[model samples]
Target: MMARPPLPLWLQDNLTLRLQDGLLSLPTSSNNSDDKNSSLTTTYNLISKRHVISSLVIPLLRHMRLKKEMSMRSKQNA
Candidate 1:
């Protein structure tokens, strides 16, 4: 059995950030309910700190994670 190589510092940091983003994204419901009242309530809910952080952080984290994975894989292959 072999241990995997450590990720480069930047990649390690990125993965950490992505993990944090995943944690921050748990408060929102993405379901498309036909109930107008629920929809309106959700819109208001987006004003909360959790919702704001999740919206701003998740996509950027996902993109960064993908980029880091690509680089990490390339390094491994080389």
Candidate 2:
């Protein structure tokens, strides 16, 4: 497989901003039972680094990989 290209500066900046926003938006823990449940879910969604990585970054990497593979195949066929 060809070496993967580096992510564009703009994309890196966007992802950084998203991660920072997610971190900042993390819900604080609460004592009330109902609030606890909601906060747990919110924390899982907002604070888990894996959420952003899996949801946004992985798909982008997959798309980039597929594009590179297609280009390599085209070059080989030429």
Candidate 3:
């Protein structure tokens, strides 16, 4: 099987920059009238960020794992 080429340096840097920007843009705590409301908002933001990160990362991991398994199977068959 042919090996895949690495991503171009500029594209890799762009992806890294975008990921950092995404993380930096996640919601942070803010001042509010009610303590309970503020707490809820903070909690919601945290959960939302977790959900977003997992949603993006989990699929990518699954795809990588699947690719690895397929590669192994191909090698075994060969």
Candidate 4:
């Protein structure tokens, strides 16, 4: 099987940066009068792509960190 190409450095860095910075919880909105009034009256919609990616990526990165640490410790012990 062909090996998958590595992610571009910027993309990898972006994910890590977002993971560190924390994900957005509130729906983004414009400052326009119409938008403000509508937002106050209507329910805010979640940005599912960002939310889902953040959810999945955070845990995966954490697991990767733990795995790396374990490998380093095992090497030290050896």
Question: What's the lDDT for candidate 4?
Answer: 0.63
Put the candidates in lDDT order, highest first.
2, 3, 1, 4
RMSD of 1: 9.0
RMSD of each: 9.0, 5.9, 7.2, 9.8
The 0-to-1 C-alpha lDDT of every candidate, in the order given, reads 0.64, 0.72, 0.69, 0.63
Model 4 Cα shift for residue 29 (angstroms): 18
Q: Give the clashing pairs for model 4.
A: none
* Per-residue lDDT over 4-76 for candidate 2, one digit per residue giving the tens place of the 0 to 100 score: 9887776777678876776425556666675547766765766565666676788789888999999999999
Q: Can you give the lDDT of residue 25 in candidate 4? A: 44
lDDT digits (tens) for residues 1-78 of candidate 1:
999988567656755665675532434565667656777566555555455466545766887899999999999999
Q: Backbone clashes per model, in order?
A: 0, 0, 0, 0
Model 4 error, position 36 (Å): 14
Ranked by TM-score, the better of candidates 2 and 3 is 3
Off by over 4 Å in 4: 5-46
lDDT (tens digit, per residue) of candidate 4 on 42-78: 3434444456467666766887799999999999999
- Model 2 TM-score is 0.45
Candidate 1: regions farther than 4 A off: 1-46
Ranking by TM-score: 3, 2, 4, 1
